[model samples]
Target chain A: MTEQRTRRIDVPVLARVEGEGALEVTIRDGRIAHLALRIFEPPRLFERFLVGHHYSELPDLVARICGICPVAYQMSALDAIERLFAPDRQSPPARWVQRMRRLFYCGEWMQSHALHIHLLAAPDFLGFDSAPAMAARYGAELRRGLALQALGNRIISLFGARSVHPVGARAGGFRRAPSLQQAGALAAQAEQAVPAAEDLVRWTAALPLPAHPQQFNCVSLRHPAEYPMIGERIVAESGLDISVDDFEDHITEFQVPHSTALHALLEGKPYLVGPLARLNLNLDRLHPGVKALLAELDIEFPSHDMYHSIVARAVEILQALLEAREILADYAPQEPAHIDLQPRAGIARGASEAPRGLLWHRYDLDSAGIIAHARIVPPTSQNQPRIEADLADALVGVGLDEDEATLRHAGEMVIRNYDPCISCATHFLRLTLDR
Target chain B: MTMPPKPPAIGARRPRLAVHKFSSCDGCQLSLLNAGESLLALAERVDIVHFAEAGIVDEHAEADIALVEGSISTPEEQTRIQAVRSRSRWILSIGACATAGGPQALRNLGDSADWIASVYRRPDWISALPASSAIGAHVPVELELPGCPVSTEQVLAALTSLLAGAAPLTEQDKVCLECKRRGQVCVLVTKGEPCLGPVTVTGCGALCPGLGRDCYGCYGPAENPEVATLAERFGDLGLDAHAVARRFMYQQSGAQPFHRAARDWRQRARPAAPPAPGAESGAAPGPQPDGSTDSHD
Candidate 1:
């Protein structure tokens, strides 16, 4: 009788990120039997706690959800609640305020993506244990990436009034708009970052990706004028086009047994949304220079491999930088930062491109403009099922024993690829793997 | 003469800092990045040994100074905080979630199971324990930086203190103090609104009031707030005790002191236990289908 094999991978220490996580994979007889990315962090549900609060407080409240993408939370919450109170969308922010908002988002993308590519994603492909280790060996690549990220932060802080959650964005408009001097200062920095960002993209394009292709229903904002940011309709590669108001109609969120977050299915199916989706669907909307650079990379639209997300992120970095420059150039202090929002009682839905992906929020308000009910679906939660699918596929294809280190690394890479913000997922762990 | 041996420093290496996250929005940690160039400069002075958001490759790396973000929700997290506590020399809790269990702690106020069922389809797969609590509740936190997302300047200053081997600094006063300092007229007095600024802490720089709105209390309550006077004042402004209590419970519903005060006032104002849980976990205290407050309220 063959011994019933017990394969388990326990990553006591998860490297290359900001939080605490442990990944476990159990295999019996070579076929995959179990997989769990145990996040044993405490629960901090900002949504449920947001009750009875003024709609104006939401951006600040939700901003506490995660530190990396406070702007993402702030922007999404503001867009959603603003639409809820003002159904007609009467108080659209001025073009300059809108521009500043986009520029801030670009800074986040640059900082986040660079961190992912050089500090998070690069180590996995190069067979190194971590990015810092990779940096130690490839000093030039690491330095350039860091410089690019710093420049991105510089731009983001210019309009955000601070990094993380900027206090400037309110329901009607900014608390205060950036002075012309500030905009000009950011433009000068953007000029230096443009070439460097381009260089990073071209360099990343050369990295070898595993030849594993899976279908992804790329979803992003479809703006006719330019790349989507503050307000736009959502479009996906799978022939689903819906305004942010109708997001719930097409995408249904369900609770999964394995996770705390509500898994979202587009028309009852899993779909992709985030940087790759944004870059692929809105390629034509990119700046001419970015378009030229995209041509040089020779990457086709709707690239199937999830690994290509890095490349897509690079393209986005360029697009974001170019967009930021345009927004800054047209800066006009005279423009109103906010508009009058008369809160009418009803349901309002809004969607916006976060640095990570598309974030959607739904709010049901009473006659007094008080929120009666609220539902939020973040990008990472939507991507969890897809991540599990990809991880399972990788495990089956490899056909190796469940070696702890190998399984752990593979699992971390998969989760990190999506940049799974667990805070966004459950909002809502102690990792307990019952063997 | 032989060269004098290098004098040994009390602490050989710079205090390694590890930033940890559990269930949170990730805003406070992002504040470090939000610091712009200062973040990089700070990074140079002290090693950011471990930060998931900053993309530190080794999650298990040890640190002398550990800045914790988010609340403890799951049983696994309960155990993880113990480990995080063991690894670091000093643990500083950042943001509301760490210092006060955050708004997510609202789950602890009621049936967490209900939340799990309502929000998720497969409740069995989720391993979370019903109530999210503050990091200090579970771990020995050395310092607490309270805010929805703490200010970048605070973060920078905290790092500076750690590098210099001094304690991280914070104010004991409320947003009202800053409001007074800024010479802004009182929104509560003028607009007949209920502002948490009198009770809430000051780190946010009286932002909401400066915009002609009442403070939502992102900085948590001031040390020893005079709640009775504030409640009386609120009633004077035409808001009932219930409305005043509800507004006070807004963002920091999970923080015990505030949660308790709000519930106590509401119960006193209303003779009976409300049909629904008031400020309980998972049961959103918002109006029911009939547009009335739930039992928890």
Candidate 2:
């Protein structure tokens, strides 16, 4: 008599993901018994500790939350603060600030998306242990990715002194403006990288990506005219549209015992965010050239395949480059880089499309502009539930009887597909199979 | 300037480098990826056996150099840092979080649960140490590269020095030295801006001062920091006690020198006096060129 075999796939270290996490799945009788993605990273309690900080310090303070995407934190915080301080939708910073902010955000998307595709996600597609291992053979391609990433940093540094925890952004506007010569040089370089970025889109699409398409809700910020970086409206492919102010109404956050990060539900279900979600929701908002490039590559948006995220990031890189080149072309430095902020007593709400997903911030401030309450919903926290859902289905696809290494690699690939910023989510990856 | 990924010599072992994380944002380790053109060569120069963020995770792998980021925030982290210490020949704690306990160290002031409950609705579910501390507090560190996110050049410079069998030279002078070297105007003296440059360490190229903002000491305390004198100067600039304490306490609150001064200043903290409506709330203090604060009085 043969006893039913129990399979347990345990990955001691989950690599290529930020922060700390362990994925546990139990399979019995060829039926999924229990599956959970747990984050063991110690809680930093950013929202709680941020209570007493002056609104002026919010940008610098929140930027520490995630090292890779400080710009997103600064932008979301500033959006809420700026909206409260400004009497209207577009004053104080005026059109120039609005344009420059988009340009700056583009830089973030470029660097972040570029970094994820080549360094983080690409290794899985190439069947290499790491990017450096992939780099030895794909020298020119790796060089191009690195150069593009640097270009993104350089563009960010143009407005911000340095990309990582940049000291440039302020509530009203920027701390300093770049010189015309600096902007022009940057514009020219961005123009040159356009071809490379285009090739990146094609190259990613050409990779041997898996055809594991799964149904998931796609959520992102939707702008009226352009691809949403900072948006007034939050949207989902499920036809759920709400004001960014009413974000808490639709999305509810819950704590899971397995993870330090909070798992979130969108209208009581899992939803996807970030590049693919942005593309699925706002494909028309992409640059005409990028849209045309997608058409050229035979890659369609509104794709259900999760592995298409790499391609989505590449397409966005091209879009960001195009946007940066245009904004920098008409570069002119403005005096009084930021507007004088008047402390107002009110609840400030802001949301922006972080490279990972929708980053939302709400701060209750006293008349002194000091924070009375603060809540930050970074993208990673929002994606944890969705990532779990993806893993359950994706793992079943990989089959329960597979070897531990195969299951671990498959699980790693599935999570990395989300580009989960465990650090941002209070997140990491260690796989444990208790079958 | 990147070298091709070729073997150094037959049977020769390249120094193994491992990156470990604790309780901070994964920024400092990211600087290694941000090395851009030189990254491939650097990867070839050293065997990167363990860097979870970069997809290589061999936690127990012995390494010639271990680059550690983040602070000790959990019991699990305490054990992990020790394991890293035992395996590594040289451990370089990078960034303010790892070397100085980072911004999270602000929790070190009291029971972490006090603030933890505020952030998480179910605080009972959270598991963290009573206080966050620098990596040095748990295990002996070979070196400390202090920065909010240590500059890319600083990381390169330190790695270069260590790879050459030498000690990395870090500036022990005040941030005022950086401003002087770049001929940047002193914001504190000229505009009464509460810049931490006079007391904080140099490393950011005096980024804040040149940008017309005060340095908030993201790089931690300088050698023989006169923070008490700097605290007094902040008071002279019309900053209230709470505001002055916040400037020193927020980023690198775990640093000894700044901690002592901030503790002294926090004593005279505000008595919960509400800010008057339309008070000067912005980038600088006192007044603006446009008289935006005309109604404040």
Candidate 3:
């Protein structure tokens, strides 16, 4: 074998991403030898911190975990605490309130998905280094995505009172439900967002996609009724069905050296979790339009080529917006914002579809409504191993020198495929392959 | 037009900006990207020498503006933070983790080694430091922007001010001030809820109180927080001392002053005194007479 030249494409700064991380690739004999997505964010130990705190304060406390998807955290925490109050029974929250909360979570997905698709993922599809550059060519598309994201924020602000880490989410339910007019206004905003979302789905579908199918264990919440949101059972790509309580049994967390976040293995195997997982497991649960759109895009599971994450996110954005409009159209003002909760003094587990993927929460509350112990598994941590695996697989057969721009671009594509939240890793990007 | 006055220089590197990480959720650094329109403008002014989350390629030794997020946990991070401090001219710590060890600091109260053993199947593979501490504990932090995921606007304001050679403005007052200003009803007094607003810092702007809930204290403690007095006040809100103390130990457990005061109060409030000596002598050292003992005395 002939010796090959290698160059280093070190990302001192990562952009359009939520957290901090670096991507390193190595080349030997003109073939990709190694790739490591190093996420060095300090671990805040949120699970450790939740110990000794009151159950009432957990939603707000953990809400600080992600700036983009605070509602997801808030909703999952509420679900867990609510389980303590009514473990075997359904919640007493008014139907309208439940409807509104689901809509609120949809708003989060719309904004987060649009931002990821347009500002972060779009650059890779277009031949640009960043969204700012992409904007020069597709200003209308960028603006439309911004509008869609802004509409999602508007809905969140309606019931949540603020877009990021809203004050409304609590152990019981929202502190205050939006007035009919406020809900109506939000619904109106989302109504306008549907077309833009549809446009995004179509645009993303038109992009060049690499066809490679990697066996993946897609994990998500399974709901028999409407698409799973705040309520459902956890399921995986491999026909493993289990309640959220069995999550610890199925997926075990282990601390790895390259990343600060503890990665989880499903039955000692690396698996995939995120939008793709959700769409694949809940294909029957989506809004008809979204389901049709998914079929149109031909995005069935076990497919390799992580770039499809962008397309999946875009489709979800459309579904979220469509769901938001429906919930808002039937807005009812007098619904109880919360159901009275009495902590059951037992371990309660809850997992919700966060914009990124399944956000899992386990709370061990005491008799007096105080939290005895807590375990939180953010989507990013669940996806860590899959990210490393994909990077390794993508690196194969590529003959670019490690320092070569092509190798670096391929490395980023692998990362962007999972839309890996390295900030969630250190704790969690947009892409450009610089030639 | 004087070329926008060429950003205020710190050193030969045109203030090469380097973003560093520790034990954290990377939320605070993401605040930089969340800056949106303002970020593009800010990027033009600063060299943005190194930001891994946003993907810039610059040597760590060359950064001038070092934005450190998260807390120090691993031994490697201890050394890495020092290296970061040496490289950057202005080290601005962002978020609660950087300023006061963040939520992860809860490990400082317990044995982190035990935590690793409990969480991981093979603890030997896990290499971590004994405790998690704020970035300022090791290096001189020129400024601090404290929050769970430092506020985006605050990040922009701090960077803009620093670039203009001005001191960053901060609300050192308590969250109570923002709540009162907003005319939100006191959740603790009226609703009989436990609140940290009286003593906790005010970055979240009394958001929880405005929603009829108590403050979770994501912003950490206020300047010169009278935590003991606040703990006493919690008694008035129908909470026991233990319940009151639990608030400070929640999200901002790393805040040394607040966490220590709370723990001390907890240790002082035991109703059960130690058991008699011979009554449980060979029985695993029963409680001592005073209730203060080395493993039940």
Please give the distance, in angstroms, between residue B280's alpha carbon in candidate 2 and its true position after superposition: 22
Lowest-sum lDDT 10-residue window in model 1 chain B: B288-297
Of 1 and 2, which scores higher on DockQ? 2
True C-alpha contacts between chains kept, each model in order:
0.42, 0.69, 0.34
Considering DockQ, which of the candidate structures 1 and 3 is the better prediction for this target? 1
Q: Interface RMSD computed for candidate 1 is what?
A: 5.4
- Which pairs of residues have clashing backbones in candidate 2? A11-A431, A14-A429, A19-A428, A20-A427, A20-A428, A21-A428, A39-A259, A422-A427
State candidate 3's TM-score. Answer: 0.85
DockQ, candidate 1, comes to 0.29
Best of the two (1, 2) by lDDT: 2
Q: What is the C-alpha lDDT of each candidate?
A: 0.69, 0.82, 0.70
Indicate which candidate wins on TM-score. 2
- Candidate 2: fraction of native contacts reproduced: 0.69
What C-alpha lDDT, on a 0 to 100 scale, does residue B221 get in candidate 2?
Answer: 86
Candidate 3 regions with alpha-carbon error over 4 angstroms:
A1-41, A87-92, A133-135, A253-260, A292-304, A334-336, A400-403, A425-435, B1-18, B59-64, B163-165, B269-297
**Local accuracy of candidate 3 as per-residue lDDT tens digits, B1-297:** 011222336754455567776666656765765555556666666667666555454545567578888778777788888888878777778888788777666656555555555555444645666567788778767777777757777888877787777767777889999988899999888877778888888877687787777877878888777878877777776776656656776556667666665556555433432322211112121122112111000
- The interface RMSD values of the models, given in order, are 5.4, 6.2, 8.7
Which tens-of-lDDT digit does each residue in A62-152 have in candidate 2? 9999888999999999999877777454664566888888888889999998899888999998899889889878889988998999999
